[model samples]
Target: MTNRHQKYEVLDGLRGIAAISVMVMHFLQDLSVPVLQSAYLSVDIFFILSGFILTHSYGDKLHHALGIGQYLKMRLVRLYPMICIGLVIGAISLCAMKLDGAAAFSVGNFVSAVGENFLLLPYLGDMSVGSFIRTSAHGVPTLGNAGNFPLNPPEWSLFFEMFASLLFVAAIRFDRRSLLKAAYASLALFVVYGMMIGINEGKLTIIVNQGWRADNFVGGFFRVTYGFLIGVAIRKMLDSDGAPHAYWMSGRLIRSARALFVAFLLITLFPTSIKGLYPLAILVFVAPMLIFQGAKLRPGGALSARACSFVGWLSYPLYCVHYPVGRLVFTYLPNSEQHIVGAAALACGLSIAAAAVLAKCVEEPVRRYLMKRFAGAASRSAAPPVRAA
Candidate 1:
């Protein structure tokens, strides 16, 4: 691989790592263990990284050209196949819960949850049908019930991601100059909105609270835009060809400084607290782009490259399936100490394998088919203009 490709590999590895953090968080939760209580914050890591990827992939299109229709089509093809799988899994899980005697399995709740999942909305706003029941052969409404892993817990993030992608597309379709300007403007507004709600209610406004509370508005908005903007800003850096100094000393120094800053922020700040220090976090979020230059990767020959790339390749599907599988295993375990650890490991491993299979067998083929079709159409359309010119 060229240096550019190797650098992308580094980012890919980081993406896998972020997904793993979330997987571990869910595993801990399911086993009733305490580790990385803030593991949920890994979503923010994903956000920043995704922002960078988007900008890298499509920033130039937004700047010098436009292709809203084709861009959205590609996004849909890339995102939807797995989502459809998740929805199917969720539906089957709900049926299994009905058999388990989970009382929340009422026809109404079942219909509502399935309906929401189908619509790509939050199931029951914040609760999922599977989560509401927790895999008991029998379902009952009680305080002991912690509803997670309903069908596809990881999908909630994807919904936000898809929405963010649309925002990016809209920037191009509308011929908006400086997408960064647009993203920053939205970020400022969201932070202020979050603060206003936080102050008024004396609590943070976290969107997607299962019942669609107004307080959750800021939370949801922040989750979508913050990471999306981070990605956008990174694209800006790459566009200038690792700007502010060109090659060697300038690029190296910029990359190093960004890495240091990102590390400091990750160690020092918490996602929940981002509401209070929103402005500062925005500045801090740009570090990843600086560090992820095409030339900075130090690939350790062959073995390391394969290992990192493998994880990167599997990360998305692994992320999608791990949480629900964790929940499923937890429900079956007999609540013994030894059992929990063993169960967590088994669940994680099985989920990762299952996700990999799905990715390879299902997601990749579908994505390829769609990409070829879309790219063909795009090429055909452009040919007419060229010939006319």
Candidate 2:
């Protein structure tokens, strides 16, 4: 029997893959290459994984040993360090652009953007109106049309992830039946929101491009809610006494499962004209299936296990830092269509290196310090008061 607290290495590897896909998608887009068209869907994978992993790790603790304040503190320690690193990178990138005269940069607007984004709040400016006082002034339009978190577009997802965490904590008191009801309610809301978006966009398929702007901000909520809760439900299933047996745990079958999982993600994320229910289907079915399978799959060997663990360790830092790093490289480097392919390739390598540095050198140390400090504070606060004799 597997240890309940052991890390799901396969899920971690899949998460790293998803993070890479997102980084590549953004890099290609910046270079005007139209590949990985559906890679934004990788964010859905992240939401699912977040739900699954968080539930697996904290489902019982939150109900017993962990208090709400302490849980939030742990989460903040895990997430906020990288966010600060990303914001600093973004600020530096903007300053570089201003120095290079590539775009206009306004200190006031940038300061405002930084302040809001640092708080993980969305930028409420008119992103389309690229003028001196708006998004353009902060160099956000050049990056990606000024999303909600103009400083770091991917940060919008992080915002939703944190929101989902809070929601998950709030529902900790729910019984199994109540949890299922909550999941179904969230699913219904997601479907309704998708249908509305599809109708308005004049597309038969559910639009996946959301949660980044003022107009489609609400869509982000439904997207994350559905995916995250589904993940939670799947975790509950896996934890139950009647959970399905993994008959496919043999070496050959394990390899096949790993291969198929990678192939399926590639196929789903590649450019395709197949629309309509495709995106919604992936979220509703594909993502959860992968998580369920990932939870059951073991690495075929020690080397493979180590590799997966490394990538999983790198995933969050990579995702958080890649956009700004790539943007910096693309902005300063040669980026003609012919040359840009090479430039993007180089940027990818550099992004990996940067992620490693940030993760090991910066994020880890900061998080350790913060967690240690928080733990000390919590222990002291919980200590008994001295009695005067």
Candidate 3:
């Protein structure tokens, strides 16, 4: 592929790795394993990647050719199919829980949860009553505190993602200098916000988990904005005349860099402690470095390229659906300390399988159909009428 059209296969692979790390982290959290405590930071990695990739893919188009409505439609088409699948799976799991006496069923709350989640909105109702009963009675798994998107907690990121996409489009209209200034301003605001919260709570760490609840939702906006803008800045740099060529590094060095990138990501995610400003540093500095490096490093061979593409294709589906699917697994399986590890492993395996099936059998087909249908309608509407002779 030409440079303009080339896919950053290494970045794709890294994204898949991040998604799996998050899945494992969630399972372990439910099972009471203290490992990978900071894996929730994977959402930051996602924000950066989304900014970088969308800028690369749609920056020029958004500025020159694509309309705001069409751009949003494209995003919805790409994202909503998997979201629907996740919502359906979550609803089914909730029903099963109620039927099996694992959870209390409230028709009003249940219907509200399904309706809100179906629209990609967080369920704001008081789930504190029936929701925690499962956790209390049977030791069934929960993501703690009925987060913003309680049905599928990880979807909190997706909500921020959509919001950030709109922000990105709006910001891209500015000149490069103005864009950079905006990004810097966002960074400043984020640091100030983090410090204020940390100091008020008498903690030294930058808060990474935000936007999952009503109180700290603003933090989520700052978190995603800063990360996304960093990504956009990296893309802008790479697109400039002085930027390094993709082939500047030798293939062997690129491969080594890829390995090191993965190692750094794992080290950052599997932190033993959440103290200090390291998490903030990683979000502000390390994530952009990874994106810049990944953009420059292509996959090594045909087999490697195929693997990267496959994993990248699988990442979104895996991320969207993993929580509900794994929750169901943990609900049914024994989650005792001895068997918890086994259960977590099984949950991960089953989640991957379900994600793959959904991607291949459902998400892909629906997206293609929607794109074709919408594109044809758009073209027809844009075409002018001919006069008869």
Candidate 4:
């Protein structure tokens, strides 16, 4: 067991911000704001975060006796609670939509959409499932096109996360160095491919509806693999103790701070031009400090820590529930930009509250039990233990 404390607070804050961005992206029309339209970056941020965490947790024990089944079970328990809640809510709203003649009530459409989510196929470039914003098979009245009553609008991303994790596990089993090299090579290939297809020039819409969109999903894969490898590489570098000055030295802090600030500025200012550089910049600066600093806190840090932790804990569940909740809230409210904006904000807030409650009351206990009873201890028999500092 490593005696280092994981920076749970920092991770929590990042997750919270990411989830909020997704919510805002969905409600872009309601907010009547054009500048914040690229909230989809939140999804990318999440992929990076996932990569970071998994690498931190499992990288040192890459050859440990962890089994595929345990990994999959943990993911299932982590995912199922929120998804089940969202499904029930979606089904009810869909029924109402059918009753009101808002949707055609095609059984095929409904089943297909539901099954796609349940099977986690949407993340793989599957378009059979409708976006949460559009009216689905139930024809239920939605909050414009933004609240499509899909069981969970954000679920497509979850599938990708799961797939990436499994692939990473396989990579770890063979050779970590090879995995890193392959990830970098794949990313280079994607950027070249994207430019060839004019994705960098903003013709993504044209390629998305056609047969060649497999590359569209490649971006997502790159995002996850890149971030994960960065974290693992950083860990390995630090573990070798090759740096001249200690990581906590004042000089290192100052240099790292400058690097992080520059990276953030570049990404926020010119997102499209320097899309690939920002993560590397962050890795250069932030990752080292994070590994060394662990979870050190200042006097007022506890309050912020709790708030961020709450948000992070609720983020996944809130994401699962937001689409249906937004749809229901909008049914009674008007549909103008401002009205829908307010409704969406309210929906986001309420969903967060709902998720927090569910996390505390249901998710934690159920997850613990499932992991103990059904996840199979033999699967993770040689897994490393993570200990607090």
Candidate 4, 1-389: lDDT as tens digits: 23323444644655665576666566543333432444454555555456556655665444555556666666676667667777777666655555543444367767776776566654222323222333323344343221222455555566666766776576554344555576577556545654555665565422211111343555555555555554444344444543325444623443432243233233333333244444344333444444333322221356766766666666777777676665555443444223555666777777777667876787668867876787767435433322100
Clash-forming residue pairs, model 2: none
- Estimate, for each residue in 140-256, the C-alpha lDDT of model 3 and write its tens digit: 433235566767778888888888878887866665556567767877777777667777788876555777765567788888888777777677777763323432332334355
- In model 2, which runs have C-alpha deviations exceeding 4 angstroms? 30-33, 98-106, 127-144, 175-177, 202-204, 241-257, 335-337, 376-389
Q: Tell me the deviation in Å of residue 170 in model 2.
A: 2.3
Give the CA lDDT, 0 to 100, for residue 276 in model 2.
Answer: 38
The RMSD of every model to the true structure, in order and in angstroms, is 6.6, 6.7, 6.3, 6.1
- Ranked by lDDT from best down, the candidates are 3, 2, 1, 4
lDDT of 1 by residue, 203-232 (tens): 665221221232343356655675566555
Candidate 3 clashes between residue pairs 3 or more apart in a chain or in different chains: none
Q: Once model 1 is optimally superposed onto the true structure by TM-score, how far is the C-alpha of residue 253 displaced, in angstroms?
A: 9.9
* Total clashing pairs for each candidate: 16, 0, 0, 6
